[model samples]
Target: MDMLLGVVVMLVKMAVVLGVALGLAAYMILLERKLLGRFQVRYGPNRVGYFGLLQPLADGLKMLLKEDIIPDGVDRRIFLVAPAVVAGTALAAFAVVPFGDGLTLFGHRVPQVVVDSNVGLLLVLALSSLAVYGLALGAWTSDNKYSLLGGIRGAAQMISYELALGLSLVPVVMHARSLSLSDIVAAQAGLPFALLEPVAFVIFIIGSLAETKRVPFDLPEAENELQAGFHTEYSGMRFALFFVGEYVNMVLLGAVTAIFFLGGWHGPFLPPIVWLALKVLAVPVFLIWTRASLPRLRYDQLMALGWKVLIPLALLNILVTGALLAAGV
Candidate 1:
């Protein structure tokens, strides 16, 4: 009976977390639209409902009701399953993200995270890297040349940037000396890694933007050449899943930046979660601002930047960090 009760409780908690995170991902799209509207001197999503608060819900409902179109001659099975894989992997990656130190619930002490693995940081990295597989499979299975091209570009881009991303973190791992995110946070209790590792932080930020496939690096979705890219043939809820997965990825990357560099849940005069949220949200806003301001890079330029510029910079950052740590300076 006790075991059954524990299982039920775990299931309930998992459901709530998944529900809330997915809902939040939906609204983040709406939030971006409304904010960008203000930036562009126009109102956004105001027509849907009450100051546009309900816009995401309406959009979600519309997608749900829309037809699930399977393009003729496509690999139907993978096409049907790819979006779920992407969205599910993205959400499942959040299980190790620590929301707070701990909380009191029904007089029981419980950790805010679903699973706090010893190698939580590595888990996050592995899951993110694996997401590219879903994209590759989806594009290939779609039987569209454009989608195939986008998928190839995306794979190459992610592969190139992920090296920089991983290298950029060597300093953090060196400083923290642990793969657990909690340990990383604890190491930064007084001083954030951003202060000590500014150059690597910048590299990481750039690499992260690439990893998330944001504008300026959104070569996969280059409309002129690839149409809608990997999901060009998808529509309605399936498309919505891909959309939500991308934004959720943004949130995840931002959270990682906060936790590893900016001092996760560390601040004055406010709760840890609040501080964490504020820091993490800043990354996505910066991304949106970049989208509104900067133009996308040419494919060759994108590849050149990753290979010629970011990779070397990230390696140098790692070396410098190693020197600093050795000098104990």
Candidate 2:
């Protein structure tokens, strides 16, 4: 009976987490548009509903009702599968993210996390790395020159930045002494890793910007050059899936940043869940602000920044952290 009960609970948690991820993804588009407009001195989507609150619902409905088109000579199977791969990986990575302290209901205590796996941090990195395949495959299968270039750029950029992104986490693991995200959060009860390892914190944020292909790092999908980049050939629901993948990735980066650096759900006074939600929302807004503020870098500059700057900085941080640990600092 305990086994059955556990299975049921897991299902419930999965359902809730998925619902939240998709729901937030749909609304994140609205939030980004709204914020981007404000940053550019304009009103955004205020017509769809009061204060534009119903815009996401309208947009989702439109996507569901649109016709899905397949370009000629494309690999139909991969074309269809790619977006799912991207969206699925983004949603799945949230499994190990803890949002609040455990709570007791009906005499049973339950963790706020979906899966408190010991290797949750590693799982997140692996899944993030996997998401790029969707971009590459979708672009390649589209058989469009624009998309093909996008695929090449996307793959190279992500692969290059991923090294720094992964390396930046070494200090977090060193400080926390655990790979589990929950354990890492608990380790920050007194002080967050961001304060302890600012170098890694900065490197992680910059690497994350590149990883998500945001703003200055968004060379793969440079609209002026690549004409919608990897998803240029995608239409209707397929395009919507890619859109979901990007927004969900933004949320994932925000959550991971909070969990590893800002002390996940660690603020005082407010509820833990509220604290996490605020932090999660903050990162996306910052990304939008960046999109408004920065110009896209030249492709060479993007590659050089990731490989020459972030990678070296992350390695130096790891060495310094190791030395500090050895010196009992």
Candidate 3:
């Protein structure tokens, strides 16, 4: 009975998390467009609903209703499955993310996260790595040279930055002395890892932006050059899935950053869930600000920054952290 109850609870949590994630992803598009417009001195979508609040809904409806076009010579089966792979993997990464502390309701205790695995960090990294497969497969199967080039660039960029991303978190893991994200959050009750490992924090942020293919690290989807990049051949809802996956990834990365460095759900005065939400929201805003201000780097410059700069700095951070630990600091 206890096992059955646990299964039911898990299903409920999964439903809630997925619903909230997808909803937030849809609205985040609206938010990004509005913010970008404001940054560029213009008004964004304000037609459909009050201040264009229903713009995402209208956009989603349009995608659902549009004809899904499969380019001639494309591999149909792989093409059909690619967007699902991207969207699914992005959503799955949230399983181990703790949004708040445990809560009790009706005399039942429940964890705030979907899965509180001891190796949650490893699972996150693994899922993130798998996302590249979707991009590569989609681009290759499309049989378009532009798509192929974009996919190759994306795969190379992600692989290069992933080293820095993983290494950047080493200090956090070492400081927390646990791979479990919940324990890591708990460890920051007094002081967040950001204060102790600011270098890692910066590296992780840059790496995450690259991972999500945001501007300045968005060479893969350089619309001006590659003509929409890897997903150039995608249309209708299939295209929408890729777009949604990016926003979902942005939110997840923000949440991960918050959990790792900003003391997840640990702020005073406000509710824990509210604190977590604010922290998560702050990251995407910063990312949008960056997108508005920074020019996309040249491909060579991008690769150099990731490999020559971020990786070496992350390694140095790990070494320094280790030395400090060894010295009992």
Indicate the worst ten consecutive residues by lDDT in candidate 1: 1-10
Kindly provide the TM-score of model 2 when superposed on the true structure, using C-alpha atoms: 0.98
Instruction: Give the TM-score of each candidate.
Output: 0.95, 0.98, 0.98
Residue 278 CA displacement from its true place in model 2, Å: 1.1
Task: Estimate the lDDT of model 1.
Answer: 0.87
Kindly list the per-residue Cα lDDT of model 2 for residues 1-329, writing each as its tens digit: 76787788789889988898888888889988988898889988998888989999998889999999998999999999999999999999999988777878557788887998999999999999999999999999999999999989999999999999999999999989999999999999899888988999999999899988999898879999999999999989899998899899999988999999999999899888888999888999899999999999999999999888989889988999999999999
Q: Candidates sorted by TM-score, descending order?
A: 3, 2, 1
Q: Candidate 2 local accuracy as lDDT?
A: 0.91
**Runs of candidate 1 exceeding 4 Å displacement:** 1-9, 104-108
Clashing pairs in 2: none
lDDT of 1 by residue, 43-131 (tens): 88897778988888888889999999898988899888988877888898888887777777666677777787889988988888988
Q: Please rank every candidate by lDDT, starting with the best.
A: 3, 2, 1
Query: Candidate 3 lDDT, tens digit per residue, 66-157?
Result: 99999899989999999999999999999999888798855788998899999999999999989999999999999999999999999999
lDDT against the true structure, per candidate, is 0.87, 0.91, 0.94
